[model samples]
Target: MLQMDPMRPLDPALPITPQLTQRLRDRIIRNHLKPGDRISETEIAKVYDVSRQPVREAFIKLADQGLLLIRPQRRTVVSRIAYQDVLDARFLREAIEADIVRLLAKTRDDALIGTLRAQIELQKRVHADDLETFTQLDEQFHRMLADAVGKAGTWSFVEGVKAQMDRVRFLSLFDYPMALLIEQHTQIVDAVEARDLDRAEENARQHLRLMLDYLPGVIAANPSFFDLPEGGLAPSVNTPTLGGEYT
Candidate 1:
Protein backbone atom coordinates (compact mmCIF):
# COMPACT_ATOMS: atom_id res chain seq x y z
CA MET A 1 0.00 0.00 0.00
CA LEU A 2 1.04 3.60 -0.48
CA GLN A 3 0.61 4.84 3.10
CA MET A 4 1.91 3.00 6.17
CA ASP A 5 0.69 2.56 9.73
CA PRO A 6 1.29 5.40 12.20
CA MET A 7 1.98 4.95 15.91
CA ARG A 8 -0.65 7.65 16.11
CA PRO A 9 -1.93 10.43 13.90
CA LEU A 10 0.15 13.41 12.93
CA ASP A 11 0.79 15.85 15.79
CA PRO A 12 0.39 19.04 13.71
CA ALA A 13 3.05 20.57 15.91
CA LEU A 14 4.55 22.08 12.77
CA PRO A 15 3.37 23.35 9.44
CA ILE A 16 1.48 21.20 6.94
CA THR A 17 4.36 19.78 4.96
CA PRO A 18 6.54 19.34 7.99
CA GLN A 19 3.79 17.65 9.94
CA LEU A 20 2.94 15.28 7.09
CA THR A 21 6.60 14.58 6.62
CA GLN A 22 7.04 13.69 10.27
CA ARG A 23 4.06 11.33 10.13
CA LEU A 24 5.32 9.60 7.00
CA ARG A 25 8.86 9.42 8.33
CA ASP A 26 7.67 7.88 11.58
CA ARG A 27 5.88 5.18 9.57
CA ILE A 28 8.98 4.52 7.50
CA ILE A 29 11.22 4.28 10.58
CA ARG A 30 8.82 1.92 12.34
CA ASN A 31 8.71 -0.41 9.30
CA HIS A 32 5.01 0.10 8.80
CA LEU A 33 6.08 1.17 5.34
CA LYS A 34 8.41 -1.51 3.96
CA PRO A 35 11.17 -0.82 1.46
CA GLY A 36 10.34 -0.71 -2.26
CA ASP A 37 6.71 0.15 -1.62
CA ARG A 38 5.50 2.82 -4.02
CA ILE A 39 3.78 5.89 -2.58
CA SER A 40 2.44 8.89 -4.44
CA GLU A 41 1.77 12.53 -3.58
CA THR A 42 -1.90 12.28 -4.40
CA GLU A 43 -2.33 9.18 -2.24
CA ILE A 44 -0.68 10.69 0.83
CA ALA A 45 -2.31 14.08 0.32
CA LYS A 46 -5.71 12.51 0.43
CA VAL A 47 -4.96 10.67 3.61
CA TYR A 48 -3.48 13.64 5.46
CA ASP A 49 -6.19 15.95 4.16
CA VAL A 50 -3.61 18.24 2.67
CA SER A 51 -3.05 19.51 -0.83
CA ARG A 52 -0.66 17.86 -3.26
CA GLN A 53 1.77 20.77 -2.86
CA PRO A 54 2.43 20.02 0.81
CA VAL A 55 2.59 16.32 0.17
CA ARG A 56 5.09 16.87 -2.63
CA GLU A 57 7.18 18.96 -0.28
CA ALA A 58 6.97 16.23 2.32
CA PHE A 59 8.29 13.73 -0.24
CA ILE A 60 11.33 15.89 -0.93
CA LYS A 61 12.06 16.16 2.81
CA LEU A 62 11.80 12.41 3.27
CA ALA A 63 14.03 11.85 0.23
CA ASP A 64 16.68 14.01 1.84
CA GLN A 65 16.58 11.79 4.93
CA GLY A 66 17.36 8.65 2.84
CA LEU A 67 13.96 7.26 3.67
CA LEU A 68 12.37 7.82 0.26
CA LEU A 69 13.82 7.25 -3.20
CA ILE A 70 12.41 9.90 -5.54
CA ARG A 71 12.60 9.12 -9.22
CA PRO A 72 11.80 11.58 -11.98
CA GLN A 73 8.30 11.17 -13.41
CA ARG A 74 7.74 8.13 -11.21
CA ARG A 75 6.27 7.33 -7.84
CA THR A 76 8.53 7.54 -4.78
CA VAL A 77 9.32 4.25 -3.07
CA VAL A 78 10.62 3.58 0.40
CA SER A 79 14.35 2.89 0.28
CA ARG A 80 15.85 -0.46 1.15
CA ILE A 81 17.53 -1.00 4.52
CA ALA A 82 21.24 -1.19 3.67
CA TYR A 83 23.05 -3.13 6.36
CA GLN A 84 26.15 -1.04 5.72
CA ASP A 85 24.23 2.14 6.51
CA VAL A 86 23.06 0.71 9.78
CA LEU A 87 26.61 -0.34 10.67
CA ASP A 88 27.98 3.07 9.84
CA ALA A 89 25.43 4.70 12.11
CA ARG A 90 26.15 2.26 14.92
CA PHE A 91 29.92 2.78 14.65
CA LEU A 92 29.60 6.54 14.58
CA ARG A 93 27.13 6.69 17.45
CA GLU A 94 29.32 4.43 19.57
CA ALA A 95 32.25 6.76 18.93
CA ILE A 96 30.38 9.95 19.75
CA GLU A 97 28.08 8.92 22.61
CA ALA A 98 30.66 6.88 24.50
CA ASP A 99 32.86 9.96 24.66
CA ILE A 100 29.94 12.16 25.64
CA VAL A 101 29.30 9.87 28.57
CA ARG A 102 32.99 9.97 29.39
CA LEU A 103 32.97 13.76 29.49
CA LEU A 104 29.85 13.87 31.61
CA ALA A 105 31.50 11.39 33.97
CA LYS A 106 34.27 13.87 34.84
CA THR A 107 31.94 16.72 35.72
CA ARG A 108 29.70 16.96 38.77
CA ASP A 109 26.29 17.95 37.48
CA ASP A 110 23.53 17.08 39.87
CA ALA A 111 21.14 18.99 37.66
CA LEU A 112 22.10 16.89 34.66
CA ILE A 113 21.63 13.69 36.59
CA GLY A 114 18.28 14.91 37.82
CA THR A 115 17.17 15.74 34.30
CA LEU A 116 18.25 12.36 32.94
CA ARG A 117 16.57 10.63 35.81
CA ALA A 118 13.39 12.54 35.06
CA GLN A 119 13.49 11.37 31.48
CA ILE A 120 13.99 7.81 32.70
CA GLU A 121 11.09 8.13 35.08
CA LEU A 122 8.93 9.35 32.23
CA GLN A 123 10.12 6.33 30.28
CA LYS A 124 9.08 4.12 33.15
CA ARG A 125 5.58 5.56 33.06
CA VAL A 126 5.32 4.92 29.33
CA HIS A 127 3.41 1.71 28.79
CA ALA A 128 5.13 -1.13 26.95
CA ASP A 129 2.56 -0.60 24.21
CA ASP A 130 3.37 3.13 23.93
CA LEU A 131 6.12 2.90 21.33
CA GLU A 132 5.59 6.50 20.26
CA THR A 133 6.32 8.05 23.67
CA PHE A 134 9.04 5.51 24.31
CA THR A 135 10.82 6.51 21.12
CA GLN A 136 10.52 10.24 21.88
CA LEU A 137 11.88 9.88 25.40
CA ASP A 138 14.63 7.65 24.09
CA GLU A 139 15.79 10.37 21.73
CA GLN A 140 15.42 12.99 24.42
CA PHE A 141 17.56 11.04 26.87
CA HIS A 142 20.42 10.84 24.37
CA ARG A 143 20.09 14.41 23.20
CA MET A 144 19.99 15.64 26.77
CA LEU A 145 23.26 13.85 27.43
CA ALA A 146 24.87 15.74 24.59
CA ASP A 147 23.41 18.96 25.92
CA ALA A 148 24.73 18.24 29.38
CA VAL A 149 28.22 17.93 27.90
CA GLY A 150 27.82 21.02 25.68
CA LYS A 151 27.85 18.74 22.63
CA ALA A 152 24.34 19.36 21.42
CA GLY A 153 25.68 20.40 18.03
CA THR A 154 27.74 17.24 17.95
CA TRP A 155 24.64 15.25 18.68
CA SER A 156 22.93 16.94 15.73
CA PHE A 157 25.83 15.97 13.51
CA VAL A 158 25.64 12.40 14.71
CA GLU A 159 21.92 12.43 13.95
CA GLY A 160 22.52 13.80 10.47
CA VAL A 161 24.89 10.95 9.66
CA LYS A 162 22.80 8.22 11.27
CA ALA A 163 19.40 8.51 9.60
CA GLN A 164 19.60 4.96 8.34
CA MET A 165 20.63 3.72 11.75
CA ASP A 166 17.70 5.52 13.31
CA ARG A 167 15.28 3.74 11.02
CA VAL A 168 16.84 0.37 11.74
CA ARG A 169 16.69 1.15 15.45
CA PHE A 170 13.00 2.06 15.40
CA LEU A 171 12.16 -1.06 13.42
CA SER A 172 14.12 -3.28 15.79
CA LEU A 173 12.46 -1.70 18.82
CA PHE A 174 9.41 -3.77 17.98
CA ASP A 175 11.23 -6.94 18.97
CA TYR A 176 13.14 -5.58 21.97
CA PRO A 177 11.49 -5.12 25.30
CA MET A 178 11.40 -1.38 26.12
CA ALA A 179 11.78 -2.11 29.81
CA LEU A 180 15.21 -3.62 29.23
CA LEU A 181 16.27 -0.51 27.33
CA ILE A 182 15.10 1.62 30.24
CA GLU A 183 17.08 -0.47 32.66
CA GLN A 184 20.15 -0.09 30.49
CA HIS A 185 19.70 3.67 30.55
CA THR A 186 19.46 3.50 34.31
CA GLN A 187 22.73 1.54 34.47
CA ILE A 188 24.38 4.15 32.24
CA VAL A 189 23.25 6.88 34.63
CA ASP A 190 24.59 4.95 37.56
CA ALA A 191 27.92 4.40 35.86
CA VAL A 192 28.29 8.05 34.98
CA GLU A 193 27.28 9.19 38.44
CA ALA A 194 29.89 6.90 39.95
CA ARG A 195 32.48 8.47 37.62
CA ASP A 196 33.25 5.04 36.24
CA LEU A 197 34.47 5.85 32.76
CA ASP A 198 35.06 2.22 31.80
CA ARG A 199 31.68 1.17 33.10
CA ALA A 200 29.89 4.09 31.46
CA GLU A 201 31.58 3.56 28.12
CA GLU A 202 30.85 -0.14 28.19
CA ASN A 203 27.22 0.52 29.01
CA ALA A 204 26.91 2.95 26.12
CA ARG A 205 28.57 0.51 23.75
CA GLN A 206 26.36 -2.36 24.83
CA HIS A 207 23.22 -0.26 24.58
CA LEU A 208 24.06 0.77 21.00
CA ARG A 209 24.86 -2.83 20.07
CA LEU A 210 21.45 -3.87 21.32
CA MET A 211 20.02 -3.14 17.88
CA LEU A 212 22.52 -5.41 16.14
CA ASP A 213 21.41 -8.31 18.30
CA TYR A 214 17.86 -7.75 17.08
CA LEU A 215 18.71 -7.24 13.40
CA PRO A 216 18.66 -10.92 12.49
CA GLY A 217 15.11 -11.28 13.72
CA VAL A 218 14.07 -8.11 11.86
CA ILE A 219 15.54 -9.54 8.64
CA ALA A 220 13.78 -12.83 9.27
CA ALA A 221 10.48 -11.08 9.79
CA ASN A 222 10.81 -8.78 6.75
CA PRO A 223 13.57 -9.77 4.39
CA SER A 224 12.44 -7.24 1.80
CA PHE A 225 13.17 -4.45 4.23
CA PHE A 226 16.97 -4.96 4.17
CA ASP A 227 20.05 -5.17 1.98
CA LEU A 228 23.37 -6.95 2.50
CA PRO A 229 26.01 -5.39 4.73
CA GLU A 230 28.95 -3.89 2.79
CA GLY A 231 31.78 -6.28 1.80
CA GLY A 232 29.69 -9.23 2.84
CA LEU A 233 29.26 -12.11 0.42
CA ALA A 234 25.52 -12.22 1.03
CA PRO A 235 22.75 -10.99 3.27
CA SER A 236 23.15 -12.45 6.74
CA VAL A 237 19.65 -13.75 7.07
CA ASN A 238 20.38 -16.58 4.65
CA THR A 239 23.62 -17.31 6.51
CA PRO A 240 24.18 -19.01 9.87
CA THR A 241 24.76 -15.65 11.60
CA LEU A 242 25.12 -11.91 10.88
CA GLY A 243 28.88 -12.71 10.65
CA GLY A 244 31.91 -11.21 12.43
CA GLU A 245 31.97 -8.20 10.09
CA TYR A 246 29.40 -6.48 12.28
CA THR A 247 31.67 -6.92 15.32
Candidate 2:
Protein backbone atom coordinates (compact mmCIF):
# COMPACT_ATOMS: atom_id res chain seq x y z
CA MET A 1 0.00 0.00 0.00
CA LEU A 2 1.23 3.49 -0.83
CA GLN A 3 1.38 6.23 1.77
CA MET A 4 1.17 10.04 1.60
CA ASP A 5 1.49 12.92 4.05
CA PRO A 6 -1.34 15.47 4.32
CA MET A 7 0.99 18.40 4.79
CA ARG A 8 3.25 17.87 1.76
CA PRO A 9 2.89 19.61 -1.61
CA LEU A 10 1.99 17.89 -4.88
CA ASP A 11 4.23 17.91 -7.91
CA PRO A 12 4.08 21.13 -9.89
CA ALA A 13 3.56 19.30 -13.17
CA LEU A 14 0.67 17.01 -12.31
CA PRO A 15 -3.04 17.71 -11.97
CA ILE A 16 -2.90 16.07 -8.54
CA THR A 17 -6.57 15.69 -7.63
CA PRO A 18 -8.03 14.12 -10.79
CA GLN A 19 -4.94 12.02 -11.41
CA LEU A 20 -5.04 10.63 -7.91
CA THR A 21 -8.78 10.09 -8.10
CA GLN A 22 -8.48 8.09 -11.34
CA ARG A 23 -5.58 6.04 -10.03
CA LEU A 24 -7.48 5.17 -6.87
CA ARG A 25 -10.61 4.43 -8.85
CA ASP A 26 -8.71 2.08 -11.15
CA ARG A 27 -7.21 0.37 -8.13
CA ILE A 28 -10.63 -0.20 -6.64
CA ILE A 29 -12.06 -1.43 -9.95
CA ARG A 30 -9.19 -3.85 -10.45
CA ASN A 31 -9.69 -5.37 -6.97
CA HIS A 32 -6.30 -4.09 -5.86
CA LEU A 33 -8.36 -2.38 -3.19
CA LYS A 34 -10.84 -5.04 -2.20
CA PRO A 35 -14.22 -4.43 -0.68
CA GLY A 36 -13.93 -3.40 2.97
CA ASP A 37 -10.19 -2.77 2.63
CA ARG A 38 -9.10 0.30 4.53
CA ILE A 39 -7.59 3.28 2.65
CA SER A 40 -5.18 5.48 4.54
CA GLU A 41 -5.06 9.07 3.33
CA THR A 42 -1.64 9.65 4.73
CA GLU A 43 -0.44 6.48 3.07
CA ILE A 44 -1.86 7.58 -0.26
CA ALA A 45 -0.27 10.99 0.14
CA LYS A 46 3.06 9.36 0.74
CA VAL A 47 2.64 6.89 -2.10
CA TYR A 48 2.03 9.71 -4.55
CA ASP A 49 4.53 11.96 -2.79
CA VAL A 50 1.82 14.54 -2.35
CA SER A 51 0.03 16.25 0.54
CA ARG A 52 -2.92 14.77 2.42
CA GLN A 53 -5.33 17.45 1.21
CA PRO A 54 -5.48 16.10 -2.36
CA VAL A 55 -5.74 12.56 -1.09
CA ARG A 56 -8.61 13.48 1.18
CA GLU A 57 -10.33 15.29 -1.65
CA ALA A 58 -9.92 12.25 -3.92
CA PHE A 59 -11.44 10.01 -1.25
CA ILE A 60 -14.50 12.23 -1.01
CA LYS A 61 -14.94 12.18 -4.80
CA LEU A 62 -14.76 8.39 -4.84
CA ALA A 63 -17.32 8.20 -2.03
CA ASP A 64 -19.67 10.45 -3.94
CA GLN A 65 -19.42 8.07 -6.89
CA GLY A 66 -20.41 5.12 -4.65
CA LEU A 67 -16.91 3.66 -4.98
CA LEU A 68 -15.76 4.37 -1.42
CA LEU A 69 -17.20 4.70 2.07
CA ILE A 70 -15.94 7.31 4.52
CA ARG A 71 -16.36 6.87 8.25
CA PRO A 72 -15.61 9.67 10.67
CA GLN A 73 -12.73 8.92 13.04
CA ARG A 74 -12.53 5.45 11.59
CA ARG A 75 -10.79 3.93 8.59
CA THR A 76 -12.19 4.64 5.11
CA VAL A 77 -12.73 1.56 3.01
CA VAL A 78 -13.65 0.72 -0.55
CA SER A 79 -17.43 0.49 -0.74
CA ARG A 80 -18.94 -2.93 -1.09
CA ILE A 81 -20.44 -3.59 -4.47
CA ALA A 82 -24.11 -4.04 -3.61
CA TYR A 83 -26.29 -6.60 -5.43
CA GLN A 84 -29.06 -4.06 -5.77
CA ASP A 85 -26.64 -1.52 -7.15
CA VAL A 86 -25.38 -4.00 -9.72
CA LEU A 87 -28.88 -4.92 -10.78
CA ASP A 88 -29.90 -1.29 -11.07
CA ALA A 89 -26.85 -0.50 -13.14
CA ARG A 90 -27.54 -3.39 -15.47
CA PHE A 91 -31.16 -2.35 -15.89
CA LEU A 92 -30.15 1.17 -16.75
CA ARG A 93 -27.67 -0.08 -19.35
CA GLU A 94 -30.18 -2.45 -20.91
CA ALA A 95 -32.88 0.18 -21.13
CA ILE A 96 -30.61 2.69 -22.81
CA GLU A 97 -28.85 0.20 -25.10
CA ALA A 98 -32.11 -1.37 -26.18
CA ASP A 99 -33.49 2.04 -27.01
CA ILE A 100 -30.35 2.91 -28.94
CA VAL A 101 -30.67 -0.25 -31.00
CA ARG A 102 -34.35 0.45 -31.67
CA LEU A 103 -33.66 3.96 -32.83
CA LEU A 104 -30.79 2.84 -35.05
CA ALA A 105 -33.01 0.22 -36.59
CA LYS A 106 -35.60 2.82 -37.46
CA THR A 107 -33.16 5.39 -38.72
CA ARG A 108 -30.80 3.04 -40.59
CA ASP A 109 -28.07 5.63 -40.68
CA ASP A 110 -25.52 4.54 -43.26
CA ALA A 111 -22.67 6.37 -41.59
CA LEU A 112 -23.34 4.62 -38.33
CA ILE A 113 -23.65 1.29 -40.06
CA GLY A 114 -20.27 1.83 -41.69
CA THR A 115 -18.72 2.70 -38.32
CA LEU A 116 -20.18 -0.42 -36.78
CA ARG A 117 -18.79 -2.57 -39.55
CA ALA A 118 -15.38 -1.06 -39.11
CA GLN A 119 -15.53 -1.67 -35.38
CA ILE A 120 -16.44 -5.30 -35.96
CA GLU A 121 -13.47 -5.67 -38.22
CA LEU A 122 -11.28 -4.12 -35.54
CA GLN A 123 -12.71 -6.48 -32.96
CA LYS A 124 -11.82 -9.44 -35.13
CA ARG A 125 -8.27 -8.19 -35.45
CA VAL A 126 -7.72 -7.80 -31.70
CA HIS A 127 -10.01 -10.51 -30.36
CA ALA A 128 -7.28 -13.11 -30.57
CA ASP A 129 -4.80 -11.31 -28.32
CA ASP A 130 -6.04 -8.18 -26.56
CA LEU A 131 -9.13 -8.41 -24.40
CA GLU A 132 -8.84 -4.81 -23.24
CA THR A 133 -8.67 -3.50 -26.78
CA PHE A 134 -11.60 -5.68 -27.78
CA THR A 135 -13.60 -4.44 -24.83
CA GLN A 136 -12.92 -0.80 -25.71
CA LEU A 137 -13.96 -1.38 -29.32
CA ASP A 138 -17.13 -3.10 -28.14
CA GLU A 139 -18.00 -0.01 -26.12
CA GLN A 140 -17.23 2.27 -29.04
CA PHE A 141 -19.41 0.19 -31.37
CA HIS A 142 -22.44 0.75 -29.17
CA ARG A 143 -21.62 4.41 -28.61
CA MET A 144 -21.35 4.91 -32.36
CA LEU A 145 -24.82 3.52 -32.86
CA ALA A 146 -26.21 5.76 -30.16
CA ASP A 147 -24.43 8.81 -31.56
CA ALA A 148 -25.82 8.09 -35.03
CA VAL A 149 -29.32 8.35 -33.62
CA GLY A 150 -28.55 11.53 -31.68
CA LYS A 151 -28.81 9.62 -28.43
CA ALA A 152 -25.20 9.98 -27.32
CA GLY A 153 -26.39 11.29 -23.96
CA THR A 154 -28.17 8.01 -23.40
CA TRP A 155 -24.95 6.20 -24.22
CA SER A 156 -23.08 8.33 -21.69
CA PHE A 157 -25.60 7.43 -18.99
CA VAL A 158 -25.35 3.78 -19.90
CA GLU A 159 -21.56 4.07 -19.85
CA GLY A 160 -21.57 5.21 -16.22
CA VAL A 161 -23.61 2.17 -15.24
CA LYS A 162 -21.46 -0.13 -17.35
CA ALA A 163 -18.34 1.11 -15.64
CA GLN A 164 -19.79 -0.01 -12.32
CA MET A 165 -20.37 -3.50 -13.70
CA ASP A 166 -17.05 -3.79 -15.53
CA ARG A 167 -15.28 -5.37 -12.57
CA VAL A 168 -17.76 -8.22 -12.59
CA ARG A 169 -17.42 -8.60 -16.31
CA PHE A 170 -13.66 -8.67 -15.99
CA LEU A 171 -13.93 -11.40 -13.39
CA SER A 172 -16.36 -13.33 -15.53
CA LEU A 173 -13.90 -13.32 -18.39
CA PHE A 174 -11.61 -15.49 -16.32
CA ASP A 175 -14.27 -18.24 -16.40
CA TYR A 176 -16.17 -17.57 -19.60
CA PRO A 177 -15.03 -17.87 -23.19
CA MET A 178 -14.15 -14.67 -24.99
CA ALA A 179 -15.33 -16.27 -28.21
CA LEU A 180 -18.88 -16.21 -26.88
CA LEU A 181 -18.70 -12.45 -26.42
CA ILE A 182 -17.32 -11.98 -29.90
CA GLU A 183 -20.07 -14.15 -31.36
CA GLN A 184 -22.73 -12.22 -29.48
CA HIS A 185 -21.46 -8.89 -30.72
CA THR A 186 -21.35 -10.26 -34.23
CA GLN A 187 -24.95 -11.34 -33.99
CA ILE A 188 -25.97 -7.93 -32.73
CA VAL A 189 -24.22 -6.24 -35.63
CA ASP A 190 -25.85 -8.60 -38.10
CA ALA A 191 -29.29 -7.91 -36.68
CA VAL A 192 -28.77 -4.19 -36.84
CA GLU A 193 -27.42 -4.29 -40.39
CA ALA A 194 -30.33 -6.42 -41.51
CA ARG A 195 -32.72 -3.79 -40.14
CA ASP A 196 -34.41 -6.36 -37.95
CA LEU A 197 -35.44 -4.14 -35.10
CA ASP A 198 -36.92 -6.91 -33.00
CA ARG A 199 -33.94 -9.16 -33.56
CA ALA A 200 -31.53 -6.36 -32.76
CA GLU A 201 -33.37 -5.56 -29.54
CA GLU A 202 -33.49 -9.23 -28.58
CA ASN A 203 -29.80 -9.61 -29.29
CA ALA A 204 -28.97 -6.67 -27.06
CA ARG A 205 -31.19 -8.03 -24.33
CA GLN A 206 -29.61 -11.46 -24.60
CA HIS A 207 -26.14 -9.96 -24.30
CA LEU A 208 -27.09 -8.28 -21.04
CA ARG A 209 -28.97 -11.35 -19.83
CA LEU A 210 -25.88 -13.46 -20.41
CA MET A 211 -23.90 -11.08 -18.23
CA LEU A 212 -26.57 -11.26 -15.51
CA ASP A 213 -26.50 -15.04 -15.66
CA TYR A 214 -22.77 -15.04 -15.14
CA LEU A 215 -22.93 -12.87 -12.01
CA PRO A 216 -23.55 -15.79 -9.66
CA GLY A 217 -20.52 -17.64 -10.92
CA VAL A 218 -18.43 -14.48 -10.61
CA ILE A 219 -19.54 -13.89 -7.04
CA ALA A 220 -18.86 -17.49 -6.16
CA ALA A 221 -15.40 -17.29 -7.65
CA ASN A 222 -14.65 -14.03 -5.85
CA PRO A 223 -16.68 -14.14 -2.68
CA SER A 224 -14.65 -11.42 -1.10
CA PHE A 225 -15.33 -8.98 -3.91
CA PHE A 226 -19.00 -8.44 -3.19
CA ASP A 227 -20.50 -6.70 -0.17
CA LEU A 228 -23.51 -8.88 0.58
CA PRO A 229 -25.23 -8.92 3.98
CA GLU A 230 -25.13 -12.64 4.88
CA GLY A 231 -23.10 -15.47 3.40
CA GLY A 232 -21.18 -12.83 1.46
CA LEU A 233 -21.36 -14.03 -2.10
CA ALA A 234 -24.32 -16.40 -1.89
CA PRO A 235 -27.30 -15.58 -4.05
CA SER A 236 -30.05 -13.61 -2.32
CA VAL A 237 -33.60 -14.91 -1.92
CA ASN A 238 -35.08 -11.55 -2.84
CA THR A 239 -33.28 -10.81 -6.06
CA PRO A 240 -33.09 -7.08 -6.58
CA THR A 241 -34.99 -5.63 -9.55
CA LEU A 242 -33.48 -3.01 -11.89
CA GLY A 243 -35.44 -0.77 -14.30
CA GLY A 244 -36.19 2.93 -14.63
CA GLU A 245 -36.60 5.80 -17.08
CA TYR A 246 -33.76 8.04 -18.18
CA THR A 247 -33.87 11.34 -20.03
Tens digits of per-residue lDDT for model 1 on 113-171? Answer: 89899889999999888888899999999999899889989998887778778777777
Candidate with best lDDT: 1
Point out where model 2 deviates above 4 Å: 3-15, 127-129, 229-247
The local distance difference test score of each candidate is 0.79, 0.73
Model 2, residue 129: distance off in Å is 5.5
How much is the lDDT of residue 17 in candidate 1?
77
For residues 44-117, what per-residue lDDT tens digits would candidate 2 score against the true structure? Answer: 87677778998899999888778889998988988877766777777777767777787777777677677777
TM-score of candidate 2 versus the correct structure, residues matched by position:
0.81
On a 0 to 100 scale, what is the lDDT of residue 149 in model 2?
A: 83
Q: What is the C-alpha RMSD of each candidate to the true structure, in Å?
A: 5.1, 5.2
CA error at residue 130 for candidate 1, angstroms: 2.9
Q: Looking at model 1, report the run of 10 residues with the lowest lDDT sum.
A: 236-245
